[model samples]
Target: MENAKSKIKLGIYGIGLLMMGVIGISSSLSTIGAKFPEASQTMIQNLISIPCIVIIPTTIVVGKLMQTISKKNIALAGIIIFLIGGSAPAFMTSFTTILVMRGILGVGIGICQVVSTAIVADNFSGVEQQKVQGTLQASQMAGAAIMVFAGGWLTEVRWNYVFFVHLLAIISLILVAVMVPNTKPEKMTTTGDVQKTKLTSATWGWVIFMFILFISVQVYSISLSFLVTEKNLGTAADSGLGLAFFAIGGIIMGLLYGSLAKRTKNCAIAVGCLMLAVAYVVIAFAGSMIVCHIGSILVGMAVSAALPGIFINTGMSVDGFSAGMAISVVTCAQNFGQFCCPYIINPISASISGGRSVNFMCFIIGAVVAAALTILMLVWGVKKNRQVI
Candidate 1:
């Protein structure tokens, strides 16, 4: 029993490490921008977001592959790819080469991200499952916090050194290889019948919810530097501090998610959306670094609260056989929203302000949309609860 517990703990940690791959380059954005003066700002920003373009499709492929492949093996292979793609950019000379490598890193992230959540749904159920899911999110946020801080420090030495952060995947690779069991695909149910999997309407609802919510929240990461600099509030390095605070807020909310979910029950997403609205309002009007940091933290908390709620609902809405695919679909929606954030939000922000750059006005727009989402989530939650009753 003790041995099994240890393995479960290790598996959770491995998933956390895998999640660190998503934002590994976030802190390096400023340094990369300085290095490539010839590149357009949009192009420089793409270096951080280009991976999501790949992650979207890769997640779907990984979901299909999970039907026959051992998750442990997939995780190991993904980490190997993650290490290579994540670290290779440090040594590359060409901007195109770096962009390609970032996409390679996305493929790796796509593989493991689906597997990580599926493993939890496959092994646990009920409150225990909720607890583990919260832990999984907390661990991911904690790992991201550490990486953001470390990556920022590394950038002080050289722009390329930030890529070295990918080497940490080696530890995750070892953990998954040794500690995570090679659970076979659930081709057959316990009754010796072929298990059929299909996504329900509720599952699709959560997917859409996650996509819309992420579109608003992602502006925080993609626009932090611009918001700070445009206001003359701080330098590029200071944006890292705001990002760190964002992660710190996520870590706190993630740790509390199980309890929060229990208390909020059907209304969890509504509460999260409301929090997000308030957070954006705070950020939109900030005049000092301290206010900006508070806003960043609130944004983190809002996301942690809302996203895990979506993941947990999506996982519970499907059977064991469909868990991975359901998660992959939701993840694809989430990533697609993130990838389209600049395109969608920027145009609207530009039209409203008659400017091309994203600014505090973007956050104001986010706040208004988030407030509307809060009402939508409340109505949906009530309808869902009535159906359950």
Candidate 2:
């Protein structure tokens, strides 16, 4: 376990923090339908989900382009696009136009998100790599907490004010220009050192597993406002607090993720998934907003605990040259889940509760599915340990 330390600038490592801000940007917008009574429920949901929809293809394309384009340039380009797309909503009155802008914003998020991790894989190795990966998730969670918490207050003022959160991307752009090192894509070598990294069955397994995990997680993303409305918990601002609580959990777990890894080894992912399952169940049955906040915290911590492991394990699964592609594939699958979760779950939710709030149904189903997977992960860990013994 030789820990190869990377000499990449510290600030460059922080660039990934901005990507998490995207979550915060749209979290409060979950209540947009309330603001514009003319908008359909589907249209209201799209304002939040549209960025994720566009992120899928853009992430894949950027991952491939990383083979030829400089990571720094790609990141810079993403920031500019993000700034434009995030800010345009404030000026436009048309919902269609805003959706289009969100799509453009997704492009920036997709490109930068992939490149951020690729940069880490390219520069760092071993324990430092794991530490940085944890830091990346932690940063995103922290950013989400700040932005979501603030956006909640702003939402109370005016829904349009929430769009201003995208202004944070300008700061990220400046950091990239000043901090990220300029370099070309890694060249393939004839020495086999640069051999293309292919995704193993394990990689695909994890990718599919994450896709399912997110279907459950999106319940929170799309249903938080509704949860508040149906339950009489409070205002959309209060729902924003629920999202913030979720981010805070992630922030706490992400900061501790490296240490947690030291103790849990491969079991961390299993435990994290189980925690999420329980958290969703708690949310499903919550009697008060306080109880809902508890659930949000658990979900956040579970995500923070699980995702860094996935990112680190996936990045390490391949050679440095191919890590970008592998990570991108993993990211693409996750975003696809985010993009489609509402559509997939919403109808099922409608039927199960007869068009009442679907959060409870979605949470219940997510818990069952995640619980099953957690058992499998635990069993797999046990067998692997026995074989080693």
Candidate 3:
């Protein structure tokens, strides 16, 4: 029993490490751009953008494969692929080849992202699941923080050295291989022996909600630096500090989620949305760096609370067989929403504000939408809990 518990703990750490794969290159974009001065800014930015695009489709495919393949094997494969693709850019001279490698890295991250969450759903339930999910998210935030700092430091030595951040996946590979069990996909069994694979209406509802929520919340991330600089409230470094506050807030919320879960219960999602609404309002009117950082923390806390709440709710709404696909669908919706946000929000903000304070306008718009979502979520939660009672 003690040995099994140790494996479970190590497996969680392995899953957490997998999240570091997607964000390894985020801080290296400027360094990479300086190396390839011939390439357009947009083309250079595609190093990050392209991976997000690839992850959308890759996640869907991995979701389907989970039903047939051993999840441990798939996770190991993903780690190997992640290590190769993420690190290969360090050696290559051609920009096109590096972009191709990033796409390959996306495939690996897609697999790891889906598998990590699905594994949590497969192994744990109720409060235990919520705690694990919270830790998983905390891991992602922590990993991203580590990679950003490490990548920045490495870039000082050599632009290419930044890519070495991915080599950390080797630790994940070892832990997962030794500690994670080779579990087959679970089937939803009934007394009649019929396998129920279809996700219910409620589960689909949460998926759609998560998609929309992502669209609204992501406005803060994409606009923060622009907003801070435009207002003359801070420099790029200060904006970076504000974002650090954001990560700190997320880590705090994630660690507290289990305790919060007991009190909030079904109302957790609504509370998170409501926090977001207030955060956007605070951010929109900020006249100083301190206020901006405060709002950033709120944004991070709100998302941390809301996203895990969604995952826990989704897991409870679906059966074991459907959980993998359900999570995949939600993950796809999230990425899709993030992809669409700039396109969707940019135009609206531009038109409404006549391009004046467009970034600030995004926060105002987000505030309004988040307020609406809070009410909607509250109603849904009340109804759902009533049905359970």
By lDDT rank, best first, the candidates go 1, 2, 3
Model 1 clash pairs? none
lDDT of 2 by residue, 184-259 (tens): 9756687746556577777787788778878777777777777778788878788888889998898889778889
TM-scores for every candidate against the unseen true structure:
0.94, 0.92, 0.86
User: Candidate 3: global Cα-lDDT?
Assistant: 0.77
lDDT of 3 by residue, 1-389 (tens): 76775686577667676564554554455557778999864566567656667878988898889988988999899889888989998899899999899889888888888888888887777777888888777776666655655765676688788788888788888988999989786444656474756788978887788778977976765677568767988644465566666667777888888887778777778888998999999988999989988997887778778888887777667777788888888877776676666667767988999756988898888898899999998897788678878
Higher-ranked by lDDT: 2 or 3? 2
Q: What is the TM-score of candidate 3?
A: 0.86
Which clashing pairs does model 2 show? none
Alpha-carbon local distance difference test for all models: 0.80, 0.78, 0.77
Top candidate, metric TM-score:
1
Off by over 4 Å in 3: 20-46, 91-97, 152-162, 186-196, 228-240, 287-289, 386-389
Candidate 2: deviation at residue 131, Å? 1.2
Worst 10 residues of 2 by lDDT: 1-10
Number of the top-ranking candidate, with lDDT as the measure:
1
Q: How many clashing residue pairs appear in each of the predictions shown? A: 0, 0, 0
